[model samples]
Target chain A: MRTAAAIAALSALLAVFPFLATAPWVMTIALFTLMYAALASAWNLVGGYAGYPSLGHAAFFGLGAYTEALWFNHHGIGAGLTPFAVLPLVGLAVAAAGLPVAWIAMRTRADVFAIVTITLLFVAQTLAYNLRGITHGAQGVAMPVPDFAPATFERPFYYAMLALLVLALLLSHAVLRSRLGLALLAIRADEDKARGVGVPVGTAKLGAFALSVGITGMAGGVWAYYLSFIYPQFAVDPLVTVAMVLMVFLGGRGTLWGPVLGAFIVAPAQQYLAYQYGASQLYLLGYAALLVLVMLVLPRGVLPTLGDRYRSRQRRARTLRADVGTGVSADTGGDIAADVAGEQP
Target chain B: MSAPLLEVRGLARRFGGVAALDDCSLTVRRSTVTGLIGPNGSGKTTLFNVVTGYLRADAGQILLEGRRVARPDPARLYRRGLCRTFQQPRVFADLSVLENLLIASGRRRAALAGPRVRADDRDRAEALLAEFSLAGLADDPAEELSYGQRKLLEFAALLMSSPSLVLLDEPTAGVNPTMVRTMERHIRARHAAGTAFLVVEHDMNLVMRLCDPVVVMAGGRVIAQGPPGDVQADPLVLDAYLGG
Candidate 1:
């Protein structure tokens, strides 16, 4: 009951936020934050839950952007379909490219898997830079703008980004409740044990990797359309990958709300700080300092850290009651009683 | 007594020059509890690891029922009705105790696909937790449990799979006396239900209490095998232990 109420309240707030945003800056910041949230949530599927730290989501993101931008620029197929209409195919293309790499990389464990992803990122960036005919050889491409009133262009993109973020959030929530989600968590905790328990670890991981990159690809497509321009460096930036991972870690890696919380906090701070300082180095330095501080104070990330403190306090109270020799133990129960008081689904 | 459920034939595993399992062989009969006993570094754990697919045998074949299972791997072995607990409990520490059991259950794949936990599976998980005296702590993160409780969780999780063959690597090692009794009882109950066991243990008293057709190992070889009384009386087995 409480969860439903909370969800409804959150929905109400999100639905009304645009109306409350009187300034253009607020809308721009919201759009950027939502985009980060989508990317981070997508990363959470593999990196956070499956326990594969992929440093190469930028590959999929850049590829997705490139796919749409290239189609809009040269294909002449845009007359019947908007660039947004091609997002799913772009996502599929990215996922297809990601699948083989994820399959090979997942055979390894820990940091080695991360290295494989980093290799993919470099390979992608190199391809975008060198593939002169297709990618325009670092000259970048300008997306043909759709005819819209000048004042209304940003509003549509803002809502589109918001829809993407919501979709990502829902997808993450569903995965968490699925058998694959459970398997991923088991793998994260202990891969050998997970396999011993009958989880098809390799197959499950590849599926997660494909799903993660697919969502990231769609987000990238949306971002490219919003920008109306794409360059190899801007599309495939390593820093974009770094920021996505940083936000995941800062918010809470495995928890559903962690990435969203991180995006809401970190993304706007990053944009605002960069706007105020005008130097990328200052914002990067601030992000680094904040990450170090989070590591020191809340090593488990924000949501989990807070959850731990809350559960510990509850335990203390329960312990006191038990020590007093009460006839009833507050802890005894079935799943329903337990589920009600535990973390929201 | 019955046809062997699992047969390890001429199994040999080596690390560099050291033969961890040197042509070792053993059999686990259907519905029987078989014990693998050896001193430290005596290749007992190595043999277990090889059979359970954690370590690949250098030269050997593992036969389940009557068919050869080549190039053993944990997931494949598990789907073929083989499950195991580790020496130190390897429960999914981040998950709740109930969740640990649920993931190990056959319903994991379906649950993953549907994104829903079956009511019956949840009920079974709860029942297993209660039977193991861990029902109260069912929702607690597995790592928060005491070392002994973790062992119980691992054992409970193995049982949740309804495995035909269970390879318990010291199921009672770190657990208390009550837990040892509970585990022994659970093993016997499961054995009567037609499951087979190949247990590796250092606790002779527990071994004598539970296992039949005892197999003793020394220096990467099976030194003797017989009824518990006969194996206990074997001079070679005594010498292997006492270094006589």
Candidate 2:
């Protein structure tokens, strides 16, 4: 109930933030944050829940971005459609692309699977880079300003992006609460045991991979339009992939709010670094260092650590209340009472 | 009495030069508890793996209910009503006891896409948990379970599949005496309900008490097969168990 109330308040605030309503820079930042959060949440589906670390998620993101770009540039489809209408088509395309990659990679073990995924990112980037005639390759294709009734408005675009992010969060929440989520957790715990009990290990992995890819792809498609350009560099950028993975891990990998928190922190920090250093490389290096530090100090990630502390405090309080109710002397022996108090709080 | 549900004819498996299973043949009757006993390195587990399609056989024909099954995939075998538990109790560590049973119940895949587990499936899972005395631990993660609890959970998980045949690889191994007795009772009840069990165990007392007919193997080949009393008295079985 408290969580729901908090989410509700956060949504209300986001829906009517002063900067988002007034400033173009704020709107752009909002859009970027929303997209990053969505993509990170999507990555969490496979990497966090299924415990399959995929370094090549950019393949799907790039595929979606490129597909949308090509469709809008060549087919005259973007003029008539709403973002919602285009999203499903983008999702379908991305899922189709993800199927075979996941099918093959799902059979491999941990480190081997990570290597395979990385190889896929390279393969996908190469394809996008070389397909110049169709994709505009290094030059990138431009998305014509979307034809809103009163011309393309930045505020409306920001809100649309925000809505997409909210939808992604809700979808992620729904999945985690569903039976599929439980099965994925089981698979993460032990694939062989999961399989022995009749969990279709391959099918579950493929499904998670496809869903994760599709969600990330949809976000990518939206992001491309928001930026008004799509390039191979943007589509399959190693930096973007690293940021997504780090955000998910740092935010608290399997927790729903972790990635959102991660995006809010990391994206703004990257922007600040770019502003101060005038070097994108510095931002990447700093982000990498942050991830390494987070892994070293809080291996389960930030959210889980906080959650554990919160749980421990609650348990201590409960024990204290229980002792009071049982008429146990609060401070009988100095040493033992100190030890008990120490244990409690 | 009746034709065996599973018939292994000249089954053989080799690991490089060493024969893990050499000309191994056996018959497993339906609705009966059959014991496979051997000393360490006697190919009991190897033969189990071969029959269950975990390992490929060098030379063999495995007939399930009189139909030849070759190159049998584990999933296919499962679909064909063969289920197994490992020597070490293997439960999904991150999942709850109920979730483990649900995974084992073979309904998670199709039902997973839905918002919630079906009421009927949940009820069935709860009933199974109660029957196995795991109701209290339903919400606890499988990782928090004791070794004996894990073994019981494994058995409960296997039962969720409602398999026609169950291959228990050391079901009593590492289990406490109290849990072992509980497992024995559960096995008896399950056997009475028409489930066939092929148990691989080292505990002779358990083997003698639970199994009707026993099969003995040595160095990857069956040396003797008969009623427990007769097999125990056989000189070859004694040699395999006690000496050569």
Candidate 3:
């Protein structure tokens, strides 16, 4: 009940944020925050829950961006239809591209899996750079922006990003509660044991990979339209991948709100600090420092650490109640029962 | 009597130059607890692994209910109603004790996508917790449980699957006397309910008490097979295992 209430409050605040914005900068920050939230949430499906740390998610993101760019530039599809038509196509294309990669990467465990994903990022970026005719080589492709008054241009894109973030959050929540989520957690806990206990390990990993890639690809497609331009480096940037991973890590891996919380903190800080100083590299250095601090203070990430503290407090209270001859009851905050409630007997 | 629930025919598995299970053969009768006992390196664990599909055999047939399974895997074996516990209890250390049982309980891939958890699964998990004397620690992570508790937890987890043939590898290795006795009781109760077990244990007293037909192995081959008392009296088994 407390969790549900907190989520409701956060959603209400986010819904009103755009309307309450007095300046263009606030909306700009909001857009970036929403995009980062979607990206982090998408990454959480595979990396956080499945315990497959994919360093090459930028490949899929780039695939989404390039697919949208190429489709718009050559085919002129975006002009004929709304972004809703283009987004799913881009997501599917990126997911199709991710299938073979997932098959190969999911075969490996831990460090090898991470390395395989990193290799994929490098390969995708290289392909994007060298594919001169399609990608326009070093010169970036331009998006045909919808004709609208400059004052209202940000509103549609802001809402689109926000909607995507919300959908991603709900999807992540659903996955966490489902048997698929349980299998992923089992795999995360012990892959061999998960297999021994009848979990189709490969299938679970690939399913997570596909869902994560599709959502991330959708975000990338949205981002390309929002920016109205895409170069190989911009579309396939390793820095974006790092930022997403760091955000998920900082908030809490495999948690519902952790990625969003991480995104809210990191995205604005990265954007504003770089904007004020005109030193993107320096802000990245700051992100690194913050991540280091988080690792040192809260190694399991912020949300999980807080949950632990709450559980400890509940335990103490229960003990006190027991001593006082008061009946001990279920801690509403403790979700172990809820987590395990689902399963075909 | 009845057709064997599991039949291992000329099973052969090798690790480099050494054959762990060289032409090993055994049968678990329907609704009976059969025991496999041997000294260290006698290929008892190897046979269990092959049966449970953890390790592939070089050349052999594993038949469950008269049907030969080809290139068996753990999940496939599990769906076919064969479940096993490891020599070292392999509970999900990070999950709560109840969660450990729940994961093993859900049978179908479709269950992963189901929006709501089944009420019966929760009730069953709670019952298993009580049965295993782990009700108090249901919310605690499996890692926090003592070794004996983990062993019991594993047994309870296997029960959730409701497997027909349970291959228990060293079920009483580190368990306390009370747990061992509870395990025996549970085994008998399940056996009465038509679930067969092929138990691999070093505990002769447990084998004598629980198993109907004891199979003795040494040097990757079964040396003797009879009732526990007859197998215990065999000179070949005594010479191989007890160094008589």
Q: What share of the true interface contacts does each candidate keep?
A: 0.74, 0.65, 0.60
Cα error of candidate 3 at position B70, Å: 0.9
lDDT of 3 at B117: 51
List ranges where model 1 is wrong by over 4 Å.
A79-81, A317-345, B1-3, B108-111
Q: Residues A130-238, candidate 3, lDDT per residue (tens digit)?
A: 9998898788888888765566567777777888898888888888888788889899988888877888778888888988999899888888887888989989989
What is the per-residue lDDT of model 1 for residues B90-112, given as tens digits with 9 covering 90 to 100?
98988998999888875534446
CAPRI grade, predicted model 3? medium
Model 2: pairs clashing at backbone N, Cα or C within 3 Å: none
Candidate 3 ranges with C-alpha deviation above 4 Å: A324-345, B1-3
List, residue by residue over A263-284, the lDDT tens digit for candidate 1: 8899999888877777657787
Best by lDDT: 3
C-alpha RMSD for every candidate: 4.8, 2.8, 5.8
Candidate 2, residue B237: lDDT: 86
Ranking by DockQ: 2, 1, 3
Error of 2 at A98 (Å): 0.9
- DockQ, all models: 0.56, 0.61, 0.55
Quote each prediction's TM-score. 0.92, 0.92, 0.92
List pairs with backbone clashes in candidate 1: A179-B111, A179-B112, A180-B112
Query: Candidate 2 — which residues are off by over 4 angstroms?
Result: A18-21, A77-84, A146-153, A320-345, B1-3
